[model samples]
Target: MSVTPARTGARPARWPTGVGRLVAGAALLTAVALLPWLSGTDPALTVLRALSADQDPTPAQLAAVREQLGLDEGPFSHLVHWLGGLPRGDAGTSWVSGEPVLPQVASAFAVSLTLMLGALAVTVAVAALVSARTLYLGSRRRLHRVRAGTGAAVLAALPKFLLASLLATVCGVWLDWFPSSGWEGPQSMVLPALALGVPSGAVIGGLLDQALPAAFNEPWARTWCAYGFPSGLTARNALRRTLAGVLPQLLPTVVALVGGAVAVEKIFNIPGLGRLALDAAMAQDLPPLQTATLFLVLLGVTAGRLLQALRHALLGPALRDGALATLHQPALPRRRSPRRVAALCAAALLTLVVAGLLRDPLHVDTAARLMPPSAAHPLGTDSLGRDLLARLGHGALRTAGVALAVTAVSAAAGLLVGLTARVGAGLTEVASTLPAVLAGLLTTAVTGPSVWGAACAVCLVAWTPYAAQAAALLEEERASGHLLASVSFGAGPRYLLRHHLLPAVLPALLRNALLRLPTTVLVLASLGFLGLGEQPPTPEWGRLLSENQPYGELAPWTVLAPAGALVLLSVLAVSATPSGRSGTRRSGAAS
Candidate 1:
């Protein structure tokens, strides 16, 4: 079945489409190819270091290396030479390995592809089970859906590295059920796949749970039920409709899985494309890094095209006849105060942070190393015999503090740009597609790994969501009857901005920022786990998890302590966020 814009009442997108998209993709690749030059790193030195770390090469040797790698021709000249070979399927040669880039990248891509496929399977299974359980609960479906959504949020908030460390510790080391840190066989993939898939599955399942109820409430569903159709058949049809609507999200979800696999692959020691990219970035190997990034970008584009086709096929008649209804207005539950819940979570986290601050995080005691919980060190000790409680407390200050700073910056910038600009829809869509991890890689490539780089990386994409939401809120306010009436009364732009738009937008924007706090922390922590955030000996949460992962089997408390802290932070963030719609209306009305 073919779908057309006219039949569906779809407005033409202002963003690049058709051949424009191809040009945009090429421009992005070109920008990535020029990163080494952009960062002002010497290509000859980089190649020499990667090729032979021990060598202190003289000027003669440096010139020879530069000539060999085409660095002598300049970045743009080399880019032209590389692009010229693309039609022949050549991606140049790796500076480090001296092998063709395509073969190395292709081999890594195969591993990553297999891991992604396995993760996809797990995501589908999880989403199906959660969705089915929510639908089958009969009278309690709404309540069950809320609880399930909360659970999913907590699960989805977990950073992949933390989860991987936990899984490896519990399932791999303690139980001996699977290999924790290698790519020996299928069993080795299990922990990594589960670590990657479970969060994504929770996200998809929560979306499905939200969409299914709305679909079941549609007039078509009621008619089927009234026509003596089997309840099961009607339910199945409703599910199909829900899936059709949810299919568009598949592109972002798949892309996220691929991006998230970076930390997961590193933790599990899987030689996937993500790991290759990380290695290449660290070694400053431009050829392999450029090739790996290009392949990843193509993978995302390919997945988007396939998912769009599937959406069209599933939409079929609905698209042609304009029968598909908007799914945004889901059946919502009664709003209740989450302040008490938030307060309780905050108290717990605060207590941990306060108690931890009293102890010394850096003092090493070899005799007390790896000790279980005791009176002196309540949370136990790490491999260095440093108190876990102290480390966790100090780490909390850094993790939560940095996350809060990033969230504030993102929210403010997003609000400012979104309110002033008419181009949010296109810009937001494009910006949202670029993952924070990818941004972090680029930032690290330029500035080297540091907390500042991680913050910059997260800030790069974190603001897009807020901008999208703010722009939407602004548009809604402009169309509201009250706003039009005010304008008719000669209300000026500043008057409307102060009285209507700001009142309506700020509350919702604040809520969005609060809700995003956990994710910011997770991203920062993920960077730390991957050695891109704070360096070791600093006691950052992600670094703590990585440092203690090896001893998870020997002393579970070391890993559990920090992991538990992150979980508490997520719970606090979610609980603190008020309901967006009701809060917005109330605030707007009050103003």
Candidate 2:
């Protein structure tokens, strides 16, 4: 048995180092310097408006405040002043609270770090247990694998906000097992941790499951078995190899964790950096917002680099030398069976959208109020007697539209950025480190709170990861033998990109977009949950959940309808991921 040979081509040059680093540093500084104006509103006016309580401030008063705060000196001057003090642990003063930005961010960061640690511990514990049971202890059973895979996919796809709400409802509202919203004690961390960690664990478990088969069937396994090696030793080595293969991919989970933290902090009402950032954005508090955003970006980049280095150290030469091998590996193909199931799920969603479009969502029928599931209303009626089925249907359409818009913007942006320049790629990775929820909040501040604003906010931070992935994929394709050959045969950049690179890049982009859709839905829902997204009267899933909160006990179905729809949509998206079919195909090919 033979594996495919590595592609023969020069690797693309790594991102700029010496002078390039200086240039990127200068570029980043420039962007940060302009953050005030880029926020879409006049920062000085935003601050002054918030400050004026009883009546609108006069132009004279605004000018006086601007002079008092040094806003009259321009952004460059302010940026230089702030940067000069940054090394001394000074981060200016918050425009809203008038508190020092550094201390405020520090306090919030402490809370965030605690929550992140708790969540990471839970994720590790869960992933370890899953790997043990599925890989080491259990026999290779198809039913067990299928069952576990299905369960993980569902959990992984469930939005953080949805999960957080359910936990809060049960533990805080119903049984009173935990405080739904606070930063009281170690116990307070438990619920938020579970809300975030559960999904992350499922993701890790899925990755482990996908990698184990190949690891177990490696040539070393054959050699060990022939010599009657100890089962424990063989299992240990296989698990180690499996982990080595999965570790590079695992770094991105940190970004997801950061993203989920925003939702967790909001739902649980923890005083973490996520919450602080939200408040700052809502109030247009540029000082705190800038500091917090900068801090978050630094945290993400530092952590990713550290993790990548650790993985490289652990795997040593194999990791360092596998670039071309990884690139040359056959592109994972989808099995037709799973593809059909995914298609059916998509069709069901389309049917709902069609029905929703044909129905009037706002039509009120008081006589049918609070009716449980019946022939007339498949999902029953809400407290206002508005059709729950219609609401759910319409909400699905709205939510789907938002998700598609986000995915489209992010994917297209990512593809262009990834393909064009290495500097852009680096910047994207830095930006990707910011949490999804945090991104939405900041964007809301810049764009103002509205549907398109929320979309723009999401698009800003959401595109980074996709761009980073696209860049990687594009680089790999460029280095592949055929594309490299085309280059050598005098093919121009435009023609090569159009005919060769685009085809290869599109599939990966599509797969990544699908993988990102569930998260995008969750982020949109999280924004609405926080009252920053689609407001009332709009039939969006998050808003629906918010509207039905008051009558949760009396009409569980109202809450259940939209919540169930979100879950179903998420499950469909997850099931449609390349993993659903690609794993099956890979396994078949391996056998």
Scored by lDDT, the top model is: 1
Give the C-alpha miss distance for residue 454 in model 2, angstroms.
Answer: 3.3
Instruction: Write candidate 1's Cα lDDT for 391-473 as tens digits.
Output: 99988888888888999999988887566443443344344445566678778877888998999989977886577556545
TM-score of 2: 0.78
lDDT of 1: 0.68
Candidate 1 deviation (Cα RMSD): 6.6
lDDT of 1 at 4: 22
List residue ranges in candidate 1 displaced over 4 A: 1-15, 138-148, 166-188, 210-247, 312-331, 335-343, 405-438, 445-449, 461-519, 529-531, 580-591
RMSD of each: 6.6, 5.3
Least accurate stretch of 10 residues (summed lDDT) in model 2? 582-591
Q: lDDT of each model, Cα atoms only? A: 0.68, 0.64
